[model samples]
Every structure is written in structure tokens, then in C-alpha cells.
Target: MASGLFTFRGKSSARADIMLGLGVAAALILAWEAVARAGFIQPQFLPAPSRVLGALWSMTTTQGLLWHAFVSTMRVWVAFLLAAAMAIPIGIMMSSYRVVGASLEPTIDFIRYLPVPALIPLSIIWFGVGEETKIFLLWLGTFFQLVLLVADDMRRVPHEYVEIAFTLGAKPRQVLTDVALRAMGPTLVDNLRITLGWCWTYLVLAEIVAADSGLGFVIWSARRYVKTPEVMAGVVVIGLIGLVTDQLLRAWHRRMFKYL
Candidate 1:
């Protein structure tokens, strides 16, 4: 009975994924047909998905939309990678030392709970209005979260892995390289993916104050002129870009670690 239930979950998960894909495809087709037929929504507002695609086509021809998309992608990529780079090292160090981890927990926890959006005012104040400010703002929102998450990942690794390594005469550095990092694999991927999504969200916030170009800034500019379709188009572009990035990351993970 236990075996049957466990096997059921694998089959269930596959079915669930298929259902989700089909459901999304169906809904999009319905929306596309409905909006195109209604014709009540002005082209400037709520352009049908087909119309949006047309706009996207023209955008590609002229390179305007692609340029903005690259700007947003650059911001998201640089900030997220920086956060991951800094967070992983710091997290490993903190987790390696019990006293350091204990002493730092309160501060890390406090910053993690603080409203990330609220930091924008101070980010601008400290960094001034420029790309650095935007990158720093995006970094702030994702950094602490990754820190706590990675530290937790390290802490949750089985003690037996380290014990066995030590009994086999492995040094501290060797155990960390072969054991601790390997143990953090799944958790690190999960956390990093989640953080990337948050960084995209934080990009919008970053643009509110300092960006001259990006999908977020484009959305705001379109909305200010009441070009809702363009606003929606910018939103669609961001969603697609994020989806592409996430799929690439998933593929990389699969290629690098078949066990996952």
C-alpha cells in the first residue's frame, strides 16, 4: 500500500504538469478570440493578443522593444548573479561557524523581515540616481533572503555526512567542498529560482525612481500616456523574458546535476 501511494505521486505530478500546460493554452486561446471579436477595447487599450503580437513584430523590426527588454534583462541578470555570488560565500562562512551563525541570526532575521520596498528611499539617498542605485536596490531585496536561505540549507545538511568525512580523515575544507556544497544543491536551486522571480519584481520598484530605460520604465511611460495596450505589451514581454530565463536555468540545472 505504501509503495502504491508513493508511485501514484510520480504519475500524479506528470498529470498535473500536463493539465497546467493545457489549461493555460486553452485560456489564452479563449482570451485571444474573445478580445479580438469584442472590438470594444480600443487598440490603445487592451489590444487583442494578436494585435499585441503584431506590435511585437513591428517592435522587432525597429529594435525599440528589444532594446528595452535587453535593458531590463541586464539589470535582472547582473543583480541576481551578484546576490547569488555574495550570498553563497557569506552563507557558507556563517554556517561553518556556530558562534558566528548564532551571533548573526538576529541581525539577518531583522533585515529579512524589514519591508524591502521601503529601502528604496534610502537606496537613492545613499547611491544617488544612476544604474548603481538601481542595481544596489535590486541587490538589497534579494541578498538577505538568499543569505538566510543558504545558511538554512547548510545547517540542514545531515551531520552524518560531515562525521563520516571526518572519520575518513577528510579535512575541514575537503568536507565543505565535497559534502556541504553537495548537500545544498536542491535547496540552493530552489532558493535561487525563487530569488530570481523576486528580483524581477524588485526591478519594477527600482525603475520607479531611477531608471531611464527598462520594461518597468516603459510600462510606466505607456500608462502615463494612457496607452494601456503598450503597458500590457510591456508586461507580456517581461513575463516571457522571465519564463525564458527560468527555463534556461532549469535546463542548466538538469544538465549539471542529473540526480535532481
Candidate 2:
């Protein structure tokens, strides 16, 4: 059992992994609770997990926490989906043709390296202090990175696969669609999963300037009032949502590519 738990680069039961992860999390939470109770830190600075939980309940019951969370989730999904839709095709084109890659890769690299927060003023100016501005910020954060990942994934497809398809009398389009795309499907899905997480990371930045209803707004509002527990609760909700989303994507990936 110890060997099973401690193996290096070896497969273990999923149940064991889940249990171990939960155990570590529980230990950390208990330690935090102890520290808070012992007055090692002021509650206002670092509230006990129990207090945070209470705050979460209160917010949910009276402060529209669930509505804010739902709004944030919707914004994230919409932006991420739009980014994926545009990036995947552009990436495929860039990888399949030298001209496309040469023309676009440099521009994408230049823009992606620019600090996203720095563009917030421009985003608001262009789209106004509305939903469009928020979505654009979220989309901008995800698209550039995802496009590069998609192009790399396409490039990493084995050359021999494309060659084999060509030798079998396949046309250029068929080779690209049937061989390259299929070969890179798993990596593309994985990249999409990673970039979706990035969209969530930008949520607070997206909503910071002009947002009335979002987890970001809730957290920012709480900070102004020094409502530490409420702020922590909002952050914890985002973390939980991201974790569940990542796990769901992993499960879908495994199921979709069982042979992998």
C-alpha cells in the first residue's frame, strides 16, 4: 500500500489519488483553523475556514453570491468558447502553410507578450463599461496563447502520418483534415483545457473596472469593506469552479481518446 501510494512515474488507483489529495487538503484546512483560533493572525486578516464557510452561506442566502458566480461562469465560458473557435482554425492554417505562419506568428507573439491589464483602458474605451468590454478582456487573455498552442500541436503531428496519407493518393486538404487534424486532436483538446483555466484567471481583471455582478465584483467589493471572510469565500468559489471544470475536461479527454 505504501509502495502504491509512493510510486514514482507509476500508475496508481484513482481512488487512492483522490483520497490522498483530499487528505492533504483537509490537513491544511485544519492547520489554518488552528492558526486562526490561536490568534496567530487576526481573523480580519485570515479568517478560519469555518468563518469563511459561514460567510459563504450568508452571502449565498442574502447577497446574491450564486447569481454573481453564475454570471462570472457564463462570461468565462462565452469568452473561452469564442477564443477556441477562432484560434483553432487560425492555428491550423498557420501550421499548414508557411506564408500563414510567417505572417501571423510574429504578430501573435508580440501582442500576447503585452500585459493584459495594460489593455484594460483600451478595452473599456473601445467597448464601453459593459459586458462587451468584460468579454473582450477575457477573450483577449485566452485567444493568443491558445492559438500558439494549437499551431504547435498541429506542427507536432508526426511527419510520417502526413507522408503516408499523401502516398496513398490523398489530396492536400484530405491529408490536412484526415491525418494532421486527427493526429493533433488530443493535444488541441488539452490546450483548450489549459487556456480555459487562463480565462478564469483573468476574470477579476476583466470585471475590475466596470462590473456589477460577478465573483470578481463580489470579491472586490468585500475588499473595500475589509470583509476578509467574504473575499476569501469568493476566491474559494472560483477555485472550486476551476477545479471541477479541469476534472471534467480531463475525464472527457480520457473518454474521447481511450486509445491514448
Candidate 3:
């Protein structure tokens, strides 16, 4: 019987993991509802999940929540793509060439440490109080981090891959394109996923300083009126957005690198 039991291996289902995750989420929601309904916390301050959902629905129906969400999403993608465009190439160069790395690493590392939010005043002055300024702020928050991450990813490419390329008489540019980039594709996808999260985290900071519209603006406006439910609703929306995008990126990563 013990021998039979040892041979009774079974495949695990991802659905089981999904169900467990949902179960945990439901339990947390129930716990929160209980706390709110039991008077354990002030409703005005904490706001029940139901109240926050109602506020979210109200915003959706009357206050253009969907539009604000779309605008914020667009801003995030725009800044992320722009940062990726510049960072990927520079990062590749830094990894592939000693001279380029030496010339840029110190400055990039130094500037990266100087808090991005602190540059709000300089960004406002340089880009003006427009969409440009907001985008610049978002870009500033994400770009340097991405550059360093991408450079590190590139550096992680196996030395043997470069040696093999050289054995085949491959040029430097060809080695970069065919070897380094290709080998680092999975890591690059992962780094971008993480950096995208960083971009979302900075969204409120980027949008709050400027004019109106977006999730951040909604939260900021609600804060002035002491609308706890609305503030919670806005926070919930941002969390949901980030969660959805993170999942989508992970799915893409799995599809693209199924072997891994």
C-alpha cells in the first residue's frame, strides 16, 4: 500500500491556485465587511468595501471614472514606451562597451538617487504646466530605473554567447542584436513589467501636481471634500488597473517564453 501510494503522483492544476487566490480575496473582503459593519472602525474614516464600491459606481456613472482611468493609462503607456525606447539602446551600449559604460554610469547612478519628485519644480519650469510637464515627471520617475535594469539584464547575457558569436565572425552590432538582445529578451520583459509598476506608483505624484483629470486628480479632489469613500474608490481603481496590467504582462511573458 505504501509502494502504491508512492507511485500515485498527480498533476497540479493552475485552476487550484486561482481558486485559492480567490478564496483568500473573498475572506479578506468578508473580514473587511464585518469590521466595517461591526463598528470596529468608523465608517467615515475607513469606509466599508460596499460603500467604496458604491462610490466607484457613482463616479463611473456621473464623474467620468472610465475616462479618467483611460487618460491615466494612456499617460502611463506613453511615458513607459518613451523611457523604454531611450533606455534599451543606452543600456545595451553601456553593457557592450566599456567606454560608454564608464562615461555614463556615474552620472546616471547619481541622478537616479536624487528623488524624482524633487524635480517637480524644475520639470514644471522646463516643460510648463501642461501635459508635457506631467509626462516628463512620469518619465523622470521611470526612465533611470529602467536604464539600470535593462543594462543589468544585458550584462547578464552569457559570456559564452558572445564567444560563440565571435567564433562565427559576427560583428559587434550583430552580436548585440542577435546574441545580447535575443538572450536577454525574457529578462527585459520582466524588467519592463516591474518598471511599469513603478510608473503606476508615480502616477498620483505626477498628476497631483498639475491641473485636473485622472485617478490622482479624483483622489486629490475627493480629499479636499473629505470624501473617504471616493478616495478609497480612487485608490481601489489604481490598484485594480495595476493588477490587471501586471497579469496581462505576465501572461505575455509566459506565452513568449514557454520554455522558461
Candidate 4:
């Protein structure tokens, strides 16, 4: 059983996997609690998980934590959907047509390499400190990266699929839609999942500059007053949200592509 649990390239039941992950997490939390109780680290620097949970409860009950979380979630989803709407088509075009790829790839490559925080100032200038700026910043962070991933997914569709479509007397557009798009469905979903995680990461950067609410704002406000537990609580909330989103996407992927 021990060897099976640690087997190389081996699969385990979902229950076993979940138990293993939970056990590790519980152990880490217990260790953290012990260290905090023993004064191995200052509470202000690294609070115990229990303290963080307490802070989370306090904030949720009295400090509008739920509202802030909702705002941040909305911002992330709006920007992510917008990015997906634009990037998927642009990426398909880029991958399907050499001219589109040549024209857009260089510019995308250049912009994506630029640090997102650096763009914050320009985003502010472009869209002011309103919700637009926040959404744009989040969109910017995810869009470039997602577009590349989308293009790569489209490109990775086997040539034989296209050939078979053509052999069946399919039109060019049908080949693109039925053959290429369908072939890349799983990978495209995977790319979106990956990029959605990227979108969440940019939320702090998006909200830190000029926002009054959201998890990032809560975290930053707590940091200003040296409220370590609140800051850690905010971070924990974001991690939890991201983890839930990832798992949902994974389940969707598994359901949609049962053969895989």
C-alpha cells in the first residue's frame, strides 16, 4: 500500500488523492499552530492558521469581507470573460492565417513581457481610477498570455484531422470550425483554466493601485496598519477561491472530454 501510494506514474483513487492532500495540509497547519504557540515566529509576522481563520470570521461578520470578495470575484470574471471573448477569436485567426500571426505575434510578445504593475500607471492614465481601469488591468494581464496559449492549442491540432476534413469535401471554414476547433477543445479549455488563474493573480495588482474594496484592498489596508492576520486572511480567501475555481474547471474538463 505504501509503494502503491508513491508509485511512479501510477494512478490513485480520487478518495486517496484527496485524503493525501488534506493530510498534508492539516499537518502543515498543525505545525504552524505549534510554532506560533511556541513563539518560534512573531505573530505579527506569521500568524497561526487559527488566528487567520479568526480574522476571516471577524472580517466577514463586521468588515464586509463578503462584499469585498464579491467585488473582486466580479472584477475577475468580467475581465476574464472579456479577455476570452477577444483572445479566442484573435488567437484562432492568428493560428489559421500566417498573415494574422505575423502581424500580431510580435506586438503580443512585446506587451506580454512588460510587467503588469508597470502598466498600472498607464492603465490609470487611459481609463482613470474607475472600474474600467481595474477591469482593463486584469484583462491585460490575462489576454496576452491567453491569446498565445490559444494560438498554440490551435496549432497543435493534428494536420491529419484537417486533411481528413478536406478529403471529406469540407469547406475551409468547416475545416476550421469542425476539425481544428473541435480537435483543440480539450486543450483550449485547459488554456482558459490556466489563464483564469493568471487573471486572479493580477487582481491584487489591479486593485492595489486605486481601489477602495476587494480582497486586494482589504489586504493592502490591513498591511498599512500592520494587521498581519487580516492580510493573511485575505490571502487565504483568494487562494481558496482560486482553488475552488480550478477544481470546477477540472471537473468540467473531465465531463466534457470523457475519453481523455
Candidate 5:
């Protein structure tokens, strides 16, 4: 059963899916370039893909945009790690104990509904306009939702597994660490991947407050001068980073949980 979860027999179909996705992406870019060149869309508003690529090259070569992208990536990693470290343990406790779950779930759900953008002013006041503010905002954006996701995953662990552990004379701690966490590890990683994507979504918001560097700052700076191509370039960089990281996480998941 475990092997079945990871080992698909349809290798050809998987390859076809990849090909289809690439074909669609290429078609869209070609269409976009054609529309821009035909003057249907003004370059100021929506630059051609080639123009955007040129802008990206100029930024990387002359404006140190690569450094800015690196800084943004680092900030995302720091925030994601911090949130995961706290959420994973708390989520486990919430799932294991009725009292804990009941006491915290309502509060977590309430906080999750509070928009991260609405807290921007307060975060600045509390942490100042520095890396702390950005990191805090990113954490705030993902932590509450992730805690709930982790808890839900934990609750889905099979009761039969736990019963078998108990029948084998396993202690509570053993059952939790040796059995439950082991079983839930794959799902937890999957949840982390989802939450990491959310972290990327919040990256621009995090860096926009007082940031002088990063892709968000680049976009804002371009906006001031109406450098639409540069702005698009920055956005494209962010999207590419998110896509690459998401794919890496998926690969890691497949590698680690071959039985999933």
C-alpha cells in the first residue's frame, strides 16, 4: 500500500503532463509578444516578453537586482523556518490533547481571519522598519494558518496505528514520537510546502514597508518612474523564485516519502 502511494505506473502520462504545461506556457508568451508588437497593448502598460527579458538583463547587470533577489530569498527562508519551528510542535500538542485543541483552535482561527496587511502599521510600530518588521510580517502571514493545517494533518493519523502501538506496550511519548510523528512526517512536509508558498505571497508585503532592497523595492522604485518593463521584470523574478522553490519542495517530498 505504501509503495503504491509513491510509485505510479504511468511514467508516459507524467511526461505528457510536463510537455503540455510547457506548450501552454510557450503559447501564452508568444501570444503576449504578438499582442504587444501589434500595438494592441501599449508597452508602457504591458511590455513585450522580449522587452521584459531585456529589462531583467539590464537590472541584473547594472542595478544589482540579482543581489536584491538573493536578499528576498534569504528573508523568505528565515521567516518560513521560524514559523515551521513553532507551528509543528504546537500543532502536535493541539491534536494530541482535547483541552489544548479546544482552548487554542478558536483563537487561532480568529487570528487567521485578521488580514496581515491590516497589521502592517502595527508591525512597523512594534518592530520598526527593519528586517525584523519584514520577518515578523511574513511569519504573521503564515503561522496561524499553518498551525491549523498541521493540526488537521496530525488529527488524520490512523487510530488503529496508535492502538497497535499501545498494544505493543509503547508509552505515550514513544507512541507520539516513534509512531505518530513518523506517520505524519510526509503530510507535515506537504503542509510546509503549501505554507511556504504563502510565505512567498507575503514577501512583497513584508519588504514594502521600509525595505530599501529586494524585488519589492525594485518594483516600487520602477513604479515611481513608470518603468513598466523593469516593474514587470521584478515581478517575473519573484514568480520564478516561487516556482523554483515550490518545485524543489515537491521533489524533496517525493524523494523523502517514496512510500507516500
Candidate 6:
């Protein structure tokens, strides 16, 4: 691979697209700053970019911000990985077995339609205000979505490839592992972006309910004290962190499938 404009000889247009996207972002920021200074918007509600950045700076020197970020991220990591582990197998099973799919379809659909927050009272009542309760919130919200997505995706895997796998003396299990999953991989890779957002939502729910620390906890605490800037600061820090993580994941995705 080359650097800069030659990074991909055919991707000159991609570079121009990137430039255009950045130009639009810059324009928005400039407009926001101009509007804020002209008193067209209240800083208290929609703070200027400079004030938001300053709040982020202030949070950096405080121990709470880093702790909050780390705690929230760690919880999300654990919950998301658990959900993925449980979901992938169940999803595969749903696609593989007619009985299982028929049995689960209605139940899963009903659960998906139900609001996870509505179950919070039950979750807290059953699990108490503990980590289990928080994890349940995350698992409940994400598992059904992942199961449906992965199962439908698996069902759509090119039948010809699976048929060929069977013709080659491969077992059903072998075909599923080597053929079906391979076909569904690109979509699974795409789901990672959605998974990140879902994980963030789980973090918010966890912090709102039982957490004494974490980004959402910080937000809640700041709101109580009317420290709007600190809350905004936490939002900025979280956004920046999420952007960095998302970029890294996207880069990995590109690198892994670049040859495709």
C-alpha cells in the first residue's frame, strides 16, 4: 500500500469524498461558533464549541472523568461479549432447526417488542441493584436483536454453497461452520458498528440505575448539581473515545477484507 493520494490508485474519488465530508463538518462548527457569539442561541443549552472543549479540558484534570469512562467501557465490553457468545450459537441453532425457529419466533418477537426499561423494575427486583441487574438490562436489549439479525442472515447464506458442502461429504455441522458462517461474515462484520452503539445505550441504562461511577453516573451526578458543563464535558470525552474506537474497528474491518 502507498501513502497519501496514492494510498489506492483507484481511490482518488474516495479522498475527495473524505475532503468534502470534513469541509461540511468544519462549516457546521464555524456556523455554530458564529451563531453562539451572536447570542442567537443560549450557551447554557447549546454551549459553544470552545466552551464544550474547555469543559472537556476541565474534566481531564479531574479523576472522576477517567474513572467514569473506564468503568462504563469495561461494563460494556463484558456485557457485549457475553451477548455475542450467547447470541451467535442461538442464532445458528434457530436457522439450523425448524423446531427451534418455530418455537422461538413468536416469543422472541414478543420480547423484542417489549421495552427493556419496563422490565427494569423486575430486573432490579429479582437481581437487586447489583451488577447482574445492569448486565441483564444490556443482555435483554441486545440479545433478541442480535439473534434475529444473525439468524436471518444465516438463513440467507447462498444455498448453492451449502449444497456443495453437503455434496462433498461434509456433515451438517461442518457445512454450517465452513460454508454458512463464511457467507454471513460480512454482515456480521457490519453489525459491529451497530453493536457499539447498542453497548453505549446499555452503559447509559446501567449508570442511570445502579451505578455510582461511570460516564452516565457522571452525567446524572452533574445534572443533580446543575454542572451542565461537566455533563457536556463527559459527553465530549465519551464521543471522542467512541470515535477513536469506532475508527480502529473500521480500520480493522477494512484491513481484514481489503482484498475483497
Q: Candidate 4's residue-wise lDDT over 1-260, tens digit each?
A: 44567789887787888889999999999998998989878899988888999999999999999999999999999999999999999999999999999999999999999888988989899999989999999999999999999999999999999999999999999999888988999999998998999888899888888899999999999999999999999999999999999999999999999997
lDDT, residue 44, model 2: 95
The models' CA-based lDDT, in order, is 0.84, 0.93, 0.90, 0.93, 0.91, 0.81
Task: Enumerate residue pairs that collide in model 5.
Answer: none
Report the alpha-carbon TM-score of model 6 versus the true structure: 0.89
Per-model TM-score on C-alpha atoms: 0.88, 0.97, 0.93, 0.97, 0.93, 0.89
Residue pairs clashing, model 3: none
Error of 6 at 131 (Å): 2.2
Superposed by TM-score, candidate 5 places the C-alpha of residue 63 at a distance from the truth, in angstroms, of: 1.0
- Model 4: colliding residue pairs: none
lDDT of 5 by residue, 38-80 (tens): 9977789989999999999999999999999999999899999
- lDDT (0-100) at residue 100 of candidate 6? 87
Over 26-87, each residue of candidate 1 has an lDDT whose tens digit, in order, gives 89878875976688766675677776666677766774888898988899889999999999
Error of 2 at 233 (Å): 0.4
How many clashes does the backbone of model 4 have? 0
lDDT of 2 at 43: 90
Clashes of 5: 0
List all candidate RMSDs to the true structure. 3.7, 1.2, 3.5, 1.2, 4.3, 4.0
TM-score of 2: 0.97
